[model samples]
Target chain A: MDAMVEQGPEGSFVLGKVDDLLNLARKNSLWYMLFGTACCAIELMQTGGPRSDADRFGMVFRATPRQSDTLILAGTITYKMASRIRLLYEQMAEPKYVIAMGSCANTGGLFQESYAVVNGGDLFLPVDVYIPGCPPRSESLIEGLMLIQQKIEKEPWLKKAWTNTKNPKDPQIEGLL
Target chain B: MTSEALIDYVKGLLGDKTKWADPEAGDNFLTVASEDWKNICQTLATDKKCSLTYLRNFTGTDYPEDDEIELTAHTFSYSEKHGLIIKTRISREAAVCDTLSKIWPAAIWYEREIFDLLGVSFNNHPDLRRILMPEDWVGHPLRKDYKQQETYRGIPTTRPA
Candidate 1:
């Protein structure tokens, strides 16, 4: 019955549940970039392995950021690597999501005191989800990914919560800016 | 040859150049004045008896309290089947050294890394740039007196903990 919807100029008025259908499709197929720089990468790979296969959620790894909708930062981000991270985020298509996987990418972990490491990826990127662990287990990462899917389903298209025009109002985010 | 004989041979070649020698130390370590560093290194590399042809590692140490920086090079010889250590102490005020990259091509990256982390300048290096740190980074972070910057390019660097 949904397939019988009119394809003419008045298609918008004919399709009442278009937003719900679009959100469902977008939430399912999230192509993530396979760009990990440290130990957290091991856990990320395990998430894609047989036991906790990410393919079950329609998640797959993409080599290039341009084709991917999600960026899974699965390791330590150093001062030298922050520019490259920002560049990759820019290359990704619109309506993208960032998942800070592990304590290193979320907040520098054991290397917090070091002079070279970046404190957190949120300082440079608009992170949508954070998975906390020195190196979060595969189960934990999958849980975080599910949370992102939920957030995607909840977002409104016309009055989107994310905006590039201004930084977030949160003090921590503002301080980073 | 044994480590003792190798140290003795290097010490003899360094003759007046040897500032300090530690034959009984844990490792065959010795220190030389910066002025004679190049000449001693050249002899160790070219001379058949003291053939320290393979450059294993080259690095620097910071001594802020004494206002000095020490650069050390570890080399081994396949022909002689032995190793030698050559180190030089330079004042922090003028931390410059003759480049060994010409002698050992591998020293190129090592020299650049030392310069990047310890602020030691290498004269006549082919291409000297930061190896581990960002190009525009302000100070040598490995230096004992280094203070971590609060921010970088508007990004807060301090940890939230």
Candidate 2:
């Protein structure tokens, strides 16, 4: 349904309605899981700290995956930790989002050649937004959160994300363990 | 005590069992055969003249050209305030050496680390398992000829070629 609007003498302005209201609510209250794997974790903590204050955007961290709507992967993902990441992603509610918060989580960064590191978070769980930098600054993470909010505002509650949210070729990266 | 004096003291106890390492080098480091490792370590730790009571560092290095892995142990005596560098070489085909864990106590974990990285086995080691790598890891990464597996679980161990 089209958003309601009332005609003013000078111009027209849309009225707050059911769909717009849902979008507003969804965009504001994004509870992300409290998770970090490496150096990027320090930046993640700074994002939640007073100066950067992610809480101003209505973003707070949940202790468990089940209660959170977002996952901010804040470091390197080794083959050993990939399965646990998958399990955490699966535990989140259906309308979940993932933020790959640093170069390591995005493309394995310095550890790319390492025999143990996973190339990217998307290899195991679908990543919605990727924040670059070996370890992205706290402000960058806040910007990433804002982008997730923008995405939530445009997306419908029942509709799946437009981007393909599929686990890569293999569910688990096979190794000794 | 100086390194030279320390070398002489060890020689007095073990006689021909120990020898000055690297004849060309002036350092007092001593090298013992793999078969004499356990006995030399015990005598050095217990005997009053040379009590190497503390195990400062115990590690292994791979020598691919020589086809042997060298195990080095650095021990110190709190009473004497002197240290000794003991080394033993084991064949790469069967990189096994006696465990000094019983004498040094602190050597148990170091022995496990050597076993983990360089694939050097310690005879009679209480728990010889991978200490740095995952327990299920295929091969010792520190070995000179180690070949990383193509995939661990289902994830490619390397970046796209």
Per residue, candidate 2 scores C-alpha lDDT tens digits across A1-177 of: 356788999999887655567878888899888899999998888888899889999999999998998999999988767877877876787678889999999888888877778888876666889999989999899889889988878776655454325445534433322
lDDT of 1 by residue, A24-53 (tens): 898899888998999999888888889999
lDDT for residue A8 in candidate 2, whole number 0-100: 98
TM-score of chain A of 1: 0.82
TM-score (all chains, Cα) for each model: 0.87, 0.84
* Each model's iRMS: 4.6, 2.8
Candidate 2 ranges with C-alpha deviation above 4 Å: A1-17, A161-177, B22-28
Error in Å for residue A12 of model 2: 16
Best TM-score goes to which candidate?
1
Residue A100 miss distance in model 1 (angstroms): 0.7
Error of 1 at A137 (Å): 2.0
